[model samples]
Target: MAGISGLKVIVKKNKMKIVVLISILVLSVSCRNKEIKSVEKIDTSKETEEIISENKSKPDTSYTTDIPHIEDFQNEVMKEEDILFNGRLKKYFTLSEFETVFGQNDSIKLLLEEEPCYTIFENKDGSVDPEDKYLYKEGSRFENSKDKVAVDEFKFTKSNFVLFKGIRLDSSTSISDLQKIFPNATKNIGSMDVYKEGKVQVIQLREDENNVSDGHINIFIKNGKLYSMHWWYPC
Candidate 1:
């Protein structure tokens, strides 16, 4: 009977060993599956960060603020016709209008010898021909002359002239004042100034002891006062 009990006990011990071995194999498989899932999650997170970084490095081509359109520029240029002069939209005077303003003075005459054509007006009673001659187009308006449609050129030789835009000027009109009015004037010499508008020299101020005179429009000054102004057009 004792021998039979020993055999039964051995069988029970073998069954317990088999169960422990199965449990160990199942636990190892479960731990390996969890580790693989963790690794996959880390790789996905890295891929997402790389995509975000690449998108940030690219330039945005759709932004276009503060860029002026071509139509805006055209509109600005079209508005030039509304420029005011002499409290009116007329930027220049016609021959008849000039005559009306200064009257039919005997001092004015046409200069056929002058290049680009001109009309000279002087002080009738001044001695030495006044050392100045106001020049304008003979038959056309001031705007026509300026636009190169009438006379070729014009200028003022005398300084004491109240011109269009109410530009009351003389030799006494300082260089600083002229710069304020014509911010584009270039310094030619001592107190001699030259202003160019649209490739043509429109105004010049000359003050030199050397008597150097060469410009479309010339302004000669003495004693810091405007002595003369000359206007002409380039051929």
Candidate 2:
């Protein structure tokens, strides 16, 4: 009986050892599969991160999508027929020439007695109908020379005179008519004391619309008609 029991114990011990070896083998295989899956997950996460970073580095050009395009203006050079008043007088008209044509001024005053004096012409007399005035700058061309008296600006007040193309100031005349008369004229930004700068439309007349730096004329409009005008030479 003892011999038989000892044999049984040996067999039981061998069976227990086999069970432990099988469990260890199963656990090793499970750990290897888990490691491989973890490696694959890490590779996939890196690829996704690289794709996101590449997308973030690109520029977004959506700002200019909705802006409207503007067309360029076609400017036309002025012609001789565009001259104001009688279309005979030219800019910088000399004092001697003016006196010869229009006779002596009603009154003359030296507004500025300095080296480059400013002379003003007034026609208060009832002989010549229009209340015309001219401003001359002495020594405008040469220093302290009376021979170089230049007509810097002129004003025609209380007059219903017709301009180029028979354009005149009257109740029927609109701003559009003035613009048609001076198509190349631009909006004037200079001083206008008689009318509100915003309420009135003032345009600067140029010999060549392309050359803005040269001498020009400023025409003021009020109540849809011509209010005042002045020729500027920037002396």
Number of the predicted model whose TM-score against the real structure is largest: 2
Q: How would you encode candidate 1's per-residue C-alpha lDDT over 1-235 as one tens digit per residue?
A: 9999999999999999999999999999999999999999999999999999998898877796898765332211101133222233232455565454434433433232332232333224422132233234322123222212122233323412434345555435665666555443334424444343222222343222232433234444444444444344332
Looking at model 2, report the run of 10 residues with the lowest lDDT sum: 136-145
Model 2: residues >4 Å from true position, as ranges? 1-85, 111-150, 157-173, 183-191, 195-200, 212-215, 233-235
Candidate 2 residue 37 Cα shift, in angstroms, is: 58
For model 1, the run of ten residues with the poorest summed lDDT: 72-81
- The whole-model lDDT of each prediction reads 0.43, 0.50
Error of 2 at 175 (Å): 2.0
Quality of model 2 by C-alpha lDDT? 0.50
